[model samples]
Target: MAALPTVQAPGIVNLSYAFTNEGNLLYREDSLNYQKEVFAYDELNRLTGWDIYDDSSIPNEEHSIV
Candidate 1:
């Protein structure tokens, strides 16, 4: 299957993403918001947790899945 390009909302010109060899999303960055989202996977490549950072004002914002 062909990989799809990442899409963002209108007027959001600064956006990027990173993926693993298995096509797993590793991280996403949005320069307009000064934020970055990171993903984590387990041995089986299953989503384990994730973290988000907002450098605009707050130090960091994190979220996890169990």
Candidate 2:
């Protein structure tokens, strides 16, 4: 797969990645270098849950997407 593109960073990711083994996205960091979001997948390599940075400003609080 192609590498994640570098954007002008519209309050979003400047750098990001996907795990090669499962091809699952790991995380995305903003230009400020703070982890903006994170991800997790199931045994079937399907996306299970993720964390969102809200007004609380917390990081990686487990929450299911489905």
Scored by TM-score, the top model is: 1
Residue 66 shift from truth in candidate 2, angstroms? 4.0
Q: Please give the range of 10 consecutive residues that has the lowest summed lDDT in model 2.
A: 12-21
- Candidate 1: which pairs clash? none
State the weakest 10-residue window (summed lDDT) of model 1: 1-10
Cα distance off (Å), candidate 2, residue 28: 1.3
What's the distance in Å from true for residue 43, model 2? Answer: 0.4
Give the Cα lDDT of each candidate: 0.79, 0.64
Q: What would the per-residue lDDT of candidate 1 be over residues 1-66, giving only the tens digit for each residue?
A: 355446567785678888888889888888788788889999899998888888754438667778
Candidate 2 lDDT, tens digit per residue, 1-66? 566644555665466455546667776555556555678887888888888653346755668867
> What is candidate 1's local distance difference test score?
0.79
Clashing pairs in 2: none
For model 2, what is the error of residue 14's alpha carbon versus the real structure, in angstroms, after optimal superposition? Answer: 2.3
